[model samples]
Target: MTVSMTTRASLLTSLRMMVLLAALLGLLYPFVVTSLSEVVFPSQSRGSLVYDENGTIVGSALVGQPFVGAEYFHGRPSAANYAPDQVSGSNLSPGNATLRERALQEARAIEERDGVTIGEIPVDLLAASGSGIDPHISPQAALIQVPRVSRERNMPITEVKNAISSATENGGIVGQPAVNVLKLNLALDEQARGMP
Candidate 1:
């Protein structure tokens, strides 16, 4: 039995629809997503890098690293060993011995560097952030290290605290107060130059 002309035409139309849908869903969709990502979130799409005034890329504000010297305000602990590409926090349970040991070591190091007792150490300073890529430090964490940063820069502690306060973002809705480490550090560098 031969099919009617109308049925043949409908079959061809269905095949064309399949091809168009495949191209749109399989290819066009991904391309559009990538383009939109680049446009809408340029910094994040490009890895969230922090750049210096001269347009040189410094480091990413996302990941925490060891900034042990008194001149710099340190960030939260990271299990990535400061490796940006390997960003992660230790997935240890609360009673994990490794976590306990690391916390103790971090507390000791901060105390030694700041010439303060361990009791003064902020919890954020000793504990790793969940994402290990937190761009901001808690306000308490920033304030705790202010004296050391001021002493190393030979600037007044009050001035350094003021800078911290200026760089901080206040609690909005449900968020806690936080200071962007990159911005704070850059401000310190600028202040060293006596720039207004």
Candidate 2:
């Protein structure tokens, strides 16, 4: 078998190009972006962690925590069960029997818990967000839970409403307003501490 020099040169050139491109895309690109993000958005770059008054890390503002207690505001229904590593949606189609059954069960539970009719329950509270770790819920969702949280926490309805108002993020013209469940619950705890 006779090997041509041109073929050998072409193989060497291709190998060299592959290595250069791989290093640039896989290594250099990630390094530059991470470094820039750290400098430009320090808190967000660090996962937007939420801290307690004792300076202990509690949770990330970006991820939802499951709060089943009556005293705390609950976030969206997480198909992943609020596990970041298992982040995913139910992936069931709208007409899926399992999805409908689950939604019906949740609606009935919400009706009992929040004293609201099934018609009034916000869809966001029934359906899990695509990421299954949404930290925020619609303002309507938060409001419906206010009575239950206020009753369980022994805080006045007015004060709980105020807490919801404070924790609610106005989406402005770009998006609909949302309430951060974790922040609202933490703030309620702080308010309870000060109450006689």
Candidate 3:
């Protein structure tokens, strides 16, 4: 009788411990972490979404996306087709013939489209970054595209130049102040609205 009672008590104690651990580790822990993250890092917890002038969700500053039209400043070329879920790069060697040819083709197209005779095309504009989802382009890349956008949008070059400057991040601080292409394009839209 004593042995059976001890066995039953041990089993019940183990069962209670399992239930308590499940409740604490599984339920309580996740809830607390999630709740705290929502309060502390709300925008990041919600995908870092950026809004348009009209308060509509445009895209996330965290992820790189493509501009649909040519009138806008273009971001780095992507290897993953700019799919939000498929962030990646071409991952080709520097000497890869296919990569070289692709870069050449991109440079040719950009030159023709922008009506510029480039002695050397910007590497950022030609090469895909490690993530290939780089929202920012080098300031030089942005500047090269300026003439085309200004001509297409019929906005003054100065306004477009200022927009690019405004969109650049950490100029000479952390790294070369790269311009976020989407942000510059948005600024251009806002600036153009104020034009005659």
Candidate 4:
């Protein structure tokens, strides 16, 4: 009888500990972290949403969006199709034949589309970023597409080039200099409106 009572007491203690820890960790921990982030870094913590001229939410600066209109600069290729919930790298190694094939195929297509030879292409235009949904591209990548966009909108090349330059960021100590493709494209659209 004494042994059974001891076992019952131990089981009750374990059950109580489990419930307490579950409430503290499972319920409380997440709430604390999220609340702290919202307080400390409100805009970034909420996905850095970008707004259009009409106050409509267009896209988040945090993630890439696909652009195939030929009149805008394209962002890096996304493995998750620009879905924030599914964002991830391609996970392909340097020796992967599939990786090489995809790169080569993209190179050829870009050359045909942009009317540029293979050697003149910038590396960023051919490679996917680590996040796969990077919204920024190298300045060279943005500049190279200026001619195409200018011709499409019938705007002077200088104006399109200026918009891209204005959007390009130096990135400072965090990363390499790059232009936010979405912002540059939006500026291009604004300029294109009054084009001849």
Give the top-scoring candidate (lDDT).
2
The Cα error of candidate 3 at residue 112, in Å, is: 0.8
For model 1, how does the per-residue alpha-carbon lDDT over 170-189 read when each residue is reduced to its tens digit?
76888788898877887898
Kindly list the per-residue Cα lDDT of model 3 for residues 91-180, writing each as its tens digit: 899989999889888888888877656557778888988887888999888888888888889878998898888888865656777788
Name the candidate, 3 or 4, with the larger lDDT value. Answer: 3
lDDT of each: 0.82, 0.89, 0.83, 0.82
- lDDT for 138 in candidate 1 is 88
**What are the RMSD figures for all models against the true structure?**
5.2, 4.1, 5.3, 4.6
Prediction 1 TM-score vs. true: 0.78
Cα misplacement distance, residue 34 of candidate 1 (Å): 2.9
Candidate 4 global TM-score: 0.81
Evaluate candidate 1 by giving its C-alpha RMSD to the native, one decimal.
Answer: 5.2
lDDT of 4 by residue, 1-196 (tens): 3355445557788999999999999999999999999999998889898876767888887667889998878887676777777888888898999888888988888887788798788888777777878889988888778788888888789988888888888878997888988888877776656532
Clash pairs detected, candidate 2: none
Ranking by TM-score: 2, 4, 3, 1
Q: Count clashes in each candidate, considering only residues at least 3 apart in sequence or on different chains.
A: 0, 0, 0, 0
Clashing pairs in 3: none
- For candidate 2, the C-alpha RMSD (Å) to the true structure equals 4.1
TM-score (all chains, Cα) for each model? 0.78, 0.91, 0.80, 0.81
